[model samples]
Target: MPFVLYAPVKDGLHDPSIAKQVTAFLSKLFQDDTTPGLHIEPINNAVDPKVRTGRVTQMYRAVLFKLVSDGVPHYVFTGVWPHDKAIEVASKAVLKMNPVNGLPELIMASEVDLTPVVERVARVPVASVAAEFPFLEYKSPGLTLAGLTEELGLDPDVAEHAWVATSEDEVMELAGKLGGWRGEALLELAVGATIADVRISLGMDTAPTVEAEAVEDEQLVSAMRTPTAQMQFAWLEDQEELRRVIEGGDLAAWRIFLHPEQRKYVEAAYGGSFRLSGGAGTGKTVVLLHRARMLAKRNPQARILLTTYTRNLADGMKRSLRDLDPSLVLADAPGKPGIYVAGVDQAASQVLGSASRDELAAAVEAVLGIGGNRATSRTSSAQKAWRDAIESVGGDLGPELRSPTFFDAEYDSVVLAQHITTLDEFLRVRRPGRGVALGRLQRQAVWEVIRSYRSSAAVAGAVDFGEVCAIAAQLAASGPIADHVLVDEGQDLTPPRWQFLRAVVPEGPDDLFVAEDSQQRIYGQRVVLGRHGIKIVGRSRRLTLNYRTTAQVLRFATSVLAGENFVDLDDEATDDTGYRSARSGPVPIRVATGSITEELDRAAAQLAEWLAAGAARDGIGILVRDQRMVERVARGLEDRDVRVRQVSKSAATGKDPQLMTMHRAKGMEFTHVLIFGANADLLPAAYLLKDLPEEERADLLQRERSLFYVAATRARDELVVMWEGKASDFLDAFTAKDHVR
Candidate 1:
């Protein structure tokens, strides 16, 4: 037999000395027909065909199962086990190739009897959930192998075995045990992926799908090793590398495998524009990055711009790029199309001139008639000048519709965003994004305040932050800068920023690809792409399988925003219809701290439980409303010797429990998340509602809801929502009764 070692077997090589022994024995056998003490004999037919057991140590035995690829036979060491358990492991081992990615993978065949479980399930065929739980669609009684096959891209044999022997719970069990993309595929199905989506994600329908045919034992033995992702057994080419992986115990490879549909988003070419919208943890960013690497590989000479809303996220994206493909060189990472990953501001500055926040603040002060900038407020907050200016009118504009917060959002997000400078232009501008209805007369009155605010800025020779984006967009439209542009967190960018992004990239096939989840848009910056000349009308797709967060956590997180309609980048209503999670965990723990002492004690106790339960110090995360809470909780955890990794301006991924402001937890996931100090005062955030009219306060609360959703979804397994004194009204509303009163 041609000797080979699979990743699974290498991963289980916990002891370096024992691994070296296996290498020595294998090398000796390869040299001749046998080693001094090594004995190889075919296992019984009740287990796998032509399976041989090699003694690794006095107590441990490893299996060498013969699998054929491309009509050649190869002996692969699937895994090692205790000598007594070798027979059991071999009896249930699966040596199969994934039909989706057409990659090979190993799965433990089930040894448990299914007859009892199937009988129990027969009592209750299928328990249907409410309409709110749209994705809970599996009807258990008749859920057949064929039904699951259409969704999981499994081989007929694999699907038949699974359906005949599995229960709903077993689906999740096999998913986790399968490992790699096979596990991911099964997990997606458990979360309610449609057959079409599963097909697309697995790349099963990408082109002509290849289904490996069964090869004879003799034919398989001569076949060369073909190992790629589909959870296949990755064969090492270097002896040193193999030795290091087996002996050094550093076999954690950072390879990202995408679903076929996700692959389609990365590889397909739209005739013009394309956009992808999905809930958080649906792998949108993964698709965006893969698309970037895909384009880079397609043409080494191409330059691609991958931009996000903030520089922090751009930096995060850069780190992910390196992890996904270390060979691809960007401005920082060394290797071709040579990607330029940065915030939208980096590209915006090229067109609008690079003015620091201090400079922008000075200009804003001059425009707002406040003299040449002495305020601590930064340039990004310049949009506040308009609100302060309008509210300066006091009761003159009347109380009925004179809410400064409402007018500010209307003018900043819609008016200035629309680039309307005159009263006539404002009158004719579309107000689709405006939440409150405004008649012409109400708008006329609002315009008077805007007109006065404008005259002050015009006379003082100043400009606000909004004007910067407007000017940048105008400048960019003059000439496109890059051949292709990919945007992450597109939902957070304002209309003007979207326009600028559109202007920077000339329209063409694969020119622009934006991935966003409007439900996670904490900034409340909504846009209709068509308004910015970036049309994604019929070229948009939505992903529904969530890879992070447990099913219980997803249910709770999504429930926070239930019944509310959200708009996608194209301004069409985005439906999270089939969005679901496969992994199950405890429903989030909501601890109401009756007193401040109870609050602190409760949080500390929860952290203790997680640490004791064997969660990685780095895997557990604690999130709070703002930096002040971050300091308080982080120090508290430190007092207990719990290492805390803080996410901030100078954030770095560290091997310790993470503590961060809920805002900083965006696009991040952890095994355990303790949302600390969810008190009423802390939640709406003193800053969120302190300045807004009571009538306009709902929008702020909604923004807080989105922020809460983002933070809650960060937990992959455990979630604890803790509070002191009266809980936030949001917390109450979220856990409200499901049935109609």
Candidate 2:
């Protein structure tokens, strides 16, 4: 029997044929490494004599480094490639343990070429280059160049190559090519981490004493079992696990490679409610999924509700949870003792649908203060009732109060939030976030408007989703519905939805887990969880290290919110102070054209370029501001002979390039993203800001900025923003003289 450890690929493993071949190879290798079909032969003249290539198929091969541990044969499978490429990789690759961190790192010995780096540096003054590349500043007596080579275990040649880089981008390019811990270390240093900081980040404080230069390979094998090494390597114990990993590919890797910070949150036992906040791609949702699994595995009969703000995201989470662990039961109802995944609206519908007619009527009366036997149905537009109400009874209201937007915000944030069902209760409400204070007479007028709205909705037998949620909260408060509840995309959850979730699961140990980022709150208003009965004051954590988006993309995404102040669920203002990225890639591309047609043409051309460069159509996304633009862009792309499918309430099913509105793109990621129609009039959508008080207008603009940030951060590797005429004011952050600073 042989021991096999699999290394994850940074880019996803998407080729079905290659995946099948890798699966076959791993199965055979686990059976017997000496099997002739595997062709596990050592490379001739390799950097490490133990480096070898195993046959995957006639045309493909797997790169492995052979080792012996406790007299048992062990093989570390790095990746699979074409036969020639595998041979080349095997010739140059070596597995060595980092002295500072005591973690095994795989690096190519023959990858660096000093000639081009030195030539690039010669064009600029050495002092200027040194200042531009922070890695060059690690020349202190405590952390000297010699320390980088000897103490830190960096290859002398590679260290010199990085030190002579002329710019941060140049070093990033080098990091991309190096592709391992060496690249990771160089990236951290280039983005302003001291050598000592890198060590600490890698858990060097607990450095083991495994000697790197031990004559026997057993010591090197021992180093692979270290905590830091486990982050990058995982042992495949059986054929079933290997097959699952081979099939799951990148997602399987995500399940295995959680950072220490994320692992802490996932594994921690909380006394009550907890909140996890981070920017997009900071692994907040990842932690949620892992935590759900941990809780389920700990108690097999626990009834958990894994939910989010929308149906599409919730559906996606259910699928991902199945992938993470298939044996965990999935329940359709609340009390079935399994993870029930649903959007908040769906959950509310389930709760309401299960109630008796009398119970349902009482619940509706509790929320709306009216009696009707008509079952609630989804409305074409929740705003339509408000518009009708304002038209019929809002005659005496001032100009500002005439808008349906004003009524919607006031009703949800104040009326529904405080459970106000009477004229006097509405009049006496504080209306904290209402921007403009209302007089007693004005409050009476608003109550009349609300009454009219409720009457009309009752006559039509249609209730808005928010009302459904409020009714569900009332119905569920009679008894516990779930043992535990987990919320993703929590910032976009409104107060009623929060109340419903709180009522679904009683307050107790590990009762509620919410993952949110205030900067991505593109849909709902700012909600304070404490006000909604789910307190997270003492049980909150923020994850600042982004693992999904590259540093270049992260910087551009974050710049959109550079000066805007955002509040977490606790209502405390938050900052992105310690936020950073674990990887680096090319800067985002920005294009401004004279007309929408030209913008569409340029976007189509960029798509062609990416396709020609081997990008997958399924991995590309074109995000727009509105559903109309989504359809228009899909038509335009079709006219240009590009395959595109418009995404609405569900995840795009096929592999054709997805065209979605910015709001629809939430909780989704892509390899390359093109945010289209980011023009001056389109992004804030003109209508949202047309007729509003100054405070409301400012708040709406902040939400729009958050929407843009969410869309921009979806791209994992590349981002391109296309606009007609002038770009959105949000892009001004990238245009100012000191923008890059």
Candidate 3:
């Protein structure tokens, strides 16, 4: 026998708990009746025949008739109804199959009979029925009058009329008049009234029309109290479960999932230049990675060019892309046909080097005012004195001036000025009387040497890395490559690089993507790319969720970055649903009143303990404010038998404990981070005050704040920020504000 099961859309097997119970009940029913076949279906919407065609429906109809013709029992499991269109169709189909199988034995299996089919059948009195329905066992008796009305789909006044009645006869009379199984069930279950009272009240054996005036008054009062009634449906259980998931490291359960501002920023799809400025641990790199992945998904054919200031960063990004998607073909070298990743200066030099040496020399001379053979004539006596002074100095001028051949005009005037400045400063500091009193004479002598040297080499001019960018920009602007250019770390671009980008990219609007965080700017002399024609197309999007650190680590880091420019992450707990950290680590910050040696010992001890506790060696990083500090810390660690690898600006060839200057640590992650020398002089030194206007001071401070933010965020499980005696004033602000515990 085949049985069909139907449920109210609102009461269908959507809830897992309810579905489990229904499945169990049907299994038990089938176990006892081996001859009857049961079919279960949900009736949320009618099946569209177009989806399957006539052949499919005919097959089902034919199978059902064969079972009936063979004297096999079949059953339709569904809610009781009075005027159910589905039931009507089923009844007609069954009648055509066999005359003896009439009505298919109607069964009421749900708590409420809101269907209209019951009224068309005889109004069976409750007293006459000996067997109790299965649905009544699941129904709650505590359901309020209003709750019952909603659950049973009845007019409040009509429900109230039957609810107030007392006897079974009256309920049956009312059900008969109402003319439906839905009306019968409403009176029986919701009103708790018997059939006797329903029959007496209506003064008939059939269902009666409900009083319209009474229903209207009841509905008005119900409407006024709807909000309070609706509050009951909020379902605190579901809310508790959701909160548990979020607090248990399932971060995706939080409202908005990603930060709301971040979603808006990404959706804008701003084609022009857009910069995301934040401190180190603020998910800037994550946003960049996600943006790159998103762009690849959107425009698979468009080639992406990612250039960082250093080769390490470029390699890290390339490795990250591979980790993100193994299928994404990445070239080991930058000049590949797909996504190109390389150092910014390397890319500029490669592109510019294609030009002829004479053409390149002309461009360099135009910028630096070198060569052109327009030398100022000097007397023989002055020339003799210049040669005599150079011989007396006894220093190698070629190496100092960066000249390969003595008379080459390719030697830059800037290089000459740098050499003269170094010699002058050396004389002032070490040998005070030699050039101090003879200032103009000293300057004239330096110029005389430069002129004579240029005349010997026959070179017109030379261009350094900066000039290469400018020249390349001009070359790319006129060439076919100008249509698409993608720049990374665009915020740290110098004036020349900006000019170079402007020269290569076409005017009036170009497809440019700039990924940068202003807070990570360690160099005080650089210009933000946006200030030089890299128009910001939309608001900066923040990637607040720290995929790299725990809440405790992020808390201490954010505290250090307290400023107007810092965007705080949503404090909702971590999402630990999919992936979770195995061990909980302590928040890493230490105060040391001892000397530099003591600080290094304490930091190394902590690193050893972290490693002992199962942290990977590659996951450890040591960050310092400058290269001098890096060298000091590296030497100190080596003395203690710690194998420390110093990350050079030029190459990445070492292992952990990777010693990196804070400037180079941007866009990288470490499982355990030890920040050394957070003193005021090193962190926000007086050097940052040089050559800056008053208005730019605030910008510098913000940059400092961002630097600290970045340093703090580098840790995944443990973060140790330590400083010597008398730490930076910035530390006081964070500690006093209880930003770190």
Candidate 4:
């Protein structure tokens, strides 16, 4: 294992130019790599006597371990800290190298107490579970500390940590807090999780450790030498990649490190449709982009379509894909493509011809058998529009029949999205989540409104966007033009959109690769994928580790979705279990102010604090609920002499810290995010709750909460949630959980 100096630590060096010093040292140390040239000097009173220190500058120190690994001298740079902190880190007397990942970590020798495990070793039996409420095992003893250590494949230093603890409770607590694969498995067992096969499923069963007396097999030697994550030590194969990493500083680590979970999905091959779904920030999109590139490299001539639900996200993907590999053929503009990077609507227009709302309006006028200029389509719900169509034709409409919003939900969310065409289909459609009772007569009245609208559209020759996508799907199913189609943010696309995607590429091995998480679906649309001809029963995978956001923010975001259930495209319950983050940061700052002015003042203060802490202006985001606040916040920032920019959906990419709505905040991440004006009425939109029943409004409220969750996760380091005038009711759930009974 050649020592890998992380690129990120360069940013904190006493001198920025110290990166060059470290680079030159690494270049020489890894010159022969196998036989080492020694510059590493021992730090007195180091945690593990084997660990040594390397010089970066006067103020910064590098803690590394030089060991004869797998019969070859290898150097592993474990960490970079300021001089004092570096000494403290090195003073942690024990080093625990993960057998599975081949990464070395340190814990203070004094931190662990082995008396609990050593004393109780024979008295307690650690089985998967006890038959009678497991009470006996919790209070009693388990197997020997040494015996447990051997089964978990832990090294001597790590094993010593448990031997010092005397209580079974302490042993279990250690497992929960331990950071490696070994502890992960032990924690699972302690919690009574039924792991099917430890060796294959969990990867806790690993190669022999260095402290072991004998190398059990010939293969174990090579396995021990190679690190799974590039973030750890690996023989640097490309000097240019190394140089780029050094020059770019910290962000370079993101390009190099692939967590074990992400690596699994990125490198896997399948014989049929495949999907990767998980909680937000779990790196599903990372795998999607990587897998797409891998396939492109394997088949250079193959045509690939990288698609998503929105133009903004698609554009973002295009930028990231270019960064991943610039030479790969990819779409440049919306329709001008080498290989397509497009939104579903854009793709549909490319294949089935574009239809503007105006054209559709004209077509509807023709269907209405009218010759005058077509009436302009006002922004309104589909149900209201249907009602208007009937009224325009002088049709009698009863009171119950006038529930335009409810019927409109039926049409837009169910009918058009599902591509339901016939009256019989409409009658049979079960709107399970509609939250309003509609009897046979009511259904008939709604059907009459829809029927009249469709007839008028037919007479006027109007075709809506739904028909455009249906046609695109039909055309795509006819032949295979693109060799592979990859989708990101698959959660937000409607059913017909998914059908169109399924049709765009002929079903085959490696044909369609999708990454999604239903919990992040801000649009509040759900589609059963199997019904749309996409089968992923055994082909779907969920990633649990979140690498993007801090654990503090992730916990709050997760709690927002707690007690709610979401479905994947295939109608399967989307699982968010085991989703976690290793990075820890400050708890989100929650502010409850009595007025908007006070909320803005507090938010501005927080932003100023973050800016003072060295955050880039663009890395901060102030997400609001609407355009009025967008303007108000911009003026407020101006008043405080903080340069600001208001970013609209039309112009999202910028260097200035952005001010936008939560809806516009999707597909974006910032280091510091301030979400304000999340008052219940504004977030769910007053229109959704105007006349809706409590049951119907509840569903919308959940979406509002989910929208906040998305905004919360955008913060990589810090999140601040603020509301004026008693705070949004959404805070009630978390408050109840946090308060003592």
At residue 326, candidate 1 shows an lDDT of: 65
Instruction: Write down the TM-score for model 1.
Output: 0.76
Best by lDDT: 2
lDDT of 2 by residue, 537-635 (tens): 988888877778988888888888878989899888886655777667777888878887888789889899999999998899899999888888888
lDDT of 4 by residue, 341-409 (tens): 877777776765434455534433333333333322223244455657657642444553454555555
Model 3: CA > 4 A from native:
1-271, 290-301, 326-336, 369-462, 480-482, 507-510, 525-531, 537-540, 561-588, 649-655, 686-705, 736-741
Backbone clash total, candidate 3 = 67
- Which 10 consecutive positions of candidate 3 have the poorest summed lDDT? 49-58
TM-score of 3: 0.49
Residue 279 Cα positional deviation in candidate 4, in Å, after optimal superposition: 1.4
Q: Which residue pairs collide, candidate 2?
A: none
What tens-digit string does per-residue lDDT give for candidate 1 at 573-622? 88876676656667787888787667767777877788899998888888
State which candidate has the highest TM-score: 2
lDDT of each: 0.66, 0.80, 0.46, 0.63
State candidate 4's TM-score: 0.75
Winner on lDDT between 1 and 2 is 2
lDDT of 4 at 20: 76
**Native-structure RMSD, model 2:** 3.7
